[model samples]
Target: MEPHAPAGRLAARAHLLAAAGRPEEGLPLLAAASGTTPAQHWAGVPWVADPTLGPRIEPGLLARTVMRLCTAVGDPAPATTVTSLRPYLTVVRHAVDAHGEHAMLLGAGSALARRLGEVRLAVEWAGRGARAQPSKLGEIWLGYAYRSAGRMPEALAALRRAVAYDPDDLSVYADVAATLADLGRLDEALRWTELALERDPDFDCVVHTAHRLRHRADGDVEHLVALADFVRDHPDDAHEHTDLEECCRNAAWLGGLPSGTPLPAGRAPVNAQPSADALHRLQRVSGPAWPHPPGAYDRALGLVLVEPWELLALLAHPETARAEQQDGLEVWACLGLLHHGTDEPWLDSSRRRLLLGLLDGEVDRVTQAALFAMVAYAWVDPEAREDVAAVVAARLTETASGANARAVAELALAAPGLDRPTRELAAATIRVPAAPRQRGRGRSLLRWRRD
Candidate 1:
């Protein structure tokens, strides 16, 4: 393997090209060579050689390269080709075994294994990593691997070791709080969260986790309000916005709120009250679960409506989350923007890009329907709405059924910003003779009695 350049240099080159925004040129190269080539391999005879220095590449170099390639290739995509890299794990582990301190290799292997759903392998690898190097990030990852495997006791012990190693790391505290909550020990989790909060109340991770633990465990309105206020004030924290969305969503869905919980002292978003009131007025009769819609759990904060973050999450999933009782949610949400009245504070440049992404990408039928339904909103930029209508109109040529989708298309045409082709397509969709009713009531996506 060492006679020439690196063994899998071709595959590495291909992946780099793919990562450099040339997937069409690079994917085929990667696919062809990835399975057969090993980027680095055991070159020397194994019979009597030392295990640590056994691989052709150094452990540190291998670790850094693997981590970088993983990022370049992107997880969960090019999955088939990436699996070929698995053989390098043996080399990584062997080197770490002799050194007993290859933190990067430990992290890379553990992360790769975890993402691949090799839970047992992750735990085994993480345990070995920590055993070899207890005072580093190895211990922290060992805790995570244990938590992933649902081994809470072992996870707790590993996290405690991490705490001992780095007493001031707020992340360790957050991890402990999460693991404790998973074990149904919210009381203990609350205490840990409080400790983290004492160190830095403004730290979004600790504060959000604390509020989540306390609110979900106790159904207390105060913590709920606090969480809401945090989201309101810190929606775009430089580092933690994405993390906050995921964490708060998990806290909301997995941990139900009490419908009867008293309102807290404050609210952040003044706009969501109507949706909250509508939700309450039309509250479903499900048992004690007090089910909250995704992104709509913090009703006490006056911001319980589905939000932009929720939309992003939905679109990211392989299959969008569904409600058997309701119309297509993505469709409704696109339509709901009609009421935004030409000036959406949330529809900033980033949001414009997100919506444009929805239009340009290969979305599902429901999402396509959303693009069609969004045409009527007089509020949206005319050019953007035109783009949406053009896509929908082009698609309607293939899937257009005049009767069922007519109401939506008719509704869409009634608004401005449509070109002639879009208008003609919209007319073709409505086989059920157009009956123009009052326009204000039915255009919104929210289907409450208040609609």
Candidate 2:
């Protein structure tokens, strides 16, 4: 590549640095390129010139470069960096109009808009791209943008259009299934999830969704069987540890295993250790906030929070668990909140301490009780249960100003295995009624019994 060739020096340097595992060093060059006019940036590139002169640029090179820079910056490029890409988006738009609707430019613009927290702009650009090209890729972006914006109906429609355009895209199938599941159409979601698995059974997200969908759709135990089978058959697969751990959790919840029972054979042991890299990846993905739209962020957060327990469960050695506890507590507390009505037998004293700390933080009292209730029902120790219940009851009283808070408190109290005193305290706060039993068809039976 010539020193002065279009994107030559910059792209070459960036590629070399990236190949050397020093991609961060190339950011300055990318940043400089971002500031240049699009035409100037492409000036010496062979493709932008008349073909007779030299080799042309590859079809998607420019767009790919921008995407590469964005990715290199981080999973989510800094908001400031994303904001800085606006000029480039303008250039892409100009190129689209000048070149009679280039799909790449439109798509890139859509992505840029989304990254910059401009969902409406993303929708507009993606829609234009789909209209221009009528391709599955364009439609996929349109659907994704719509979903990110919380426009679920439009998102579903666009995703369906993408499916019509290309039934073979397993990612689209997974997205469609997830969207349907979010809308409470679990049966339809299960069908799409199965289709996704049929296309690519090895994809972790697809498999995860299929299992979740099956559980939701009909309380089927098939997903557990499939997970066990996968673990037995593919022990060396990269995802084996996580998958097996999840299988154990589902087994406990769905199969009614008692607390502390050994998982079935071929399952990873509760003490199975996770690598440092895996833990780091989890924290990065599930950290305090996401760059996505709020609804999407909440959904992603809920999934991430609920998932780490299996991994946490596997780190059973007390010292190891303690060392990792701080890094994982946020996830656990969030999980407690999400699993409000569900029992999690994994909560121990250390984990409970982590949760108790959250109460002293900025979180609302009622939300804190709800989270505590999740942990409370899981406590096997009497003292721990009392402590958790006391916290819940106190928070319930403190938040007595809202019916919502009281309702949440009642739900927490309804969790099985509370002591009588805690139950009485809850009863004092809310109307606790007797458990009703159905009467037999017994007017004649009562008369006969009397006789």
Candidate 3:
């Protein structure tokens, strides 16, 4: 009984530190404690009795806390640690049985799995819980896991169940609508989005959904301009920034065609098409600024950064024509290259040039891994292949975080440094849940394709 005392004290301190807005300082201590701690005990679950001690925290609390710390720490090892912990189902089972009041613990597990990029595992745990007991919380989680895994129909079904259980849960409805739109079921998606907005007009997610739908349905330039205006006014909301970015991307994709107007750039010119070299050049232009990119300089100063994926899309946009346009363009190009997956020639002539550009600048481990993954995917051309492989090998040996860590693991498998089983497991980590009928076509867009 007393054995839990020391750990409890440390855990409390960690929690206090995190709560006090000192997450950066609190994270390492949490990680050390997490690594030293054994799997949590589910049996002999005790309720709060000690007046001085307060309520007893669940054994699995460490795992969940460790994950939150990892997010705060912004390191790759924490994600790898969570992935490594996946084999032990008993740990999760114990937590579920012991912490009846802490359903959030189960939600945390599902979220952690998703964060580790283990979409299938995320769905599996969340789905099982939903099946076992159809609580509103469980249903909402099941829907999210399904959405992340690219199973749109299943996600909608789960969301419907969740809404039926509690129609007031605007968050669940917004998520469901988003997934529906991703699957191209725009009409249905719009309806659900409307339902959510009707319930809570100021809901952030609902606002985002309406913004996205307007672009898709009406391609309203005025609406996009308004959204951009709103984002500038509400700079603190990160999601708003994402919405504005998407609006910009949509505008570029529309390529000046009027709203509700037909596609104008329907055909590529004989030589004007996006050549392999042109694509590569466009991607490379994004950058390796010493002070980091213009808008992201402050965020970069903080601990372990995973280069934002949205930056790449911005680079790919035609409207990104400023001198600093390279900041967004290159990142967007990288994302497209990533979309090519690890087994194709998507990188080809264009990708190599872009990678070279990135190398020439001050790219970090995460960006390097992203470039390496693209090279691995475009595994053709002996000279380029060697260059990319060298980059990957070097990068893998050093530190990594976020998607880069996963990319590094994949590189090891492709190059022969990592063992077969570990490599397969890593690949499995990103494998999404079984695709539902509606989302089958969009599967490639959602998951992190190989290489």
**Count of residue pairs whose backbone atoms collide, per candidate:** 0, 3, 11
Q: What lDDT would each prediction earn against the true structure?
A: 0.49, 0.49, 0.46
**Per-residue lDDT of candidate 1, residues 284-361 (tens digit):** 321222112223222212212444444333323213222442223343343333323335443354434444445442
What clash pairs does model 1 have?
none
Tell me the spans in candidate 3 whose CA falls farther than 4 Å from its real position. Answer: 1-103, 235-241, 247-451
Candidate 3 has an lDDT of: 0.46
What lDDT tens digits, residue by residue, belong to model 2 across residues 76-163? 3455565445444544444555553667656766776676677888888788888888988888788878887889888899999998
Among these predictions, the greatest TM-score belongs to 1
After the best TM-score superposition of candidate 2, give how far the Cα of residue 273 lies from its true spot, in angstroms: 26
Which scores better on lDDT, 2 or 3? 2
Candidate 1 at 100: error in angstroms? Answer: 6.6
* Alpha-carbon runs more than 4 Å astray in model 1: 1-54, 66-103, 220-232, 235-326, 329-339, 342-451
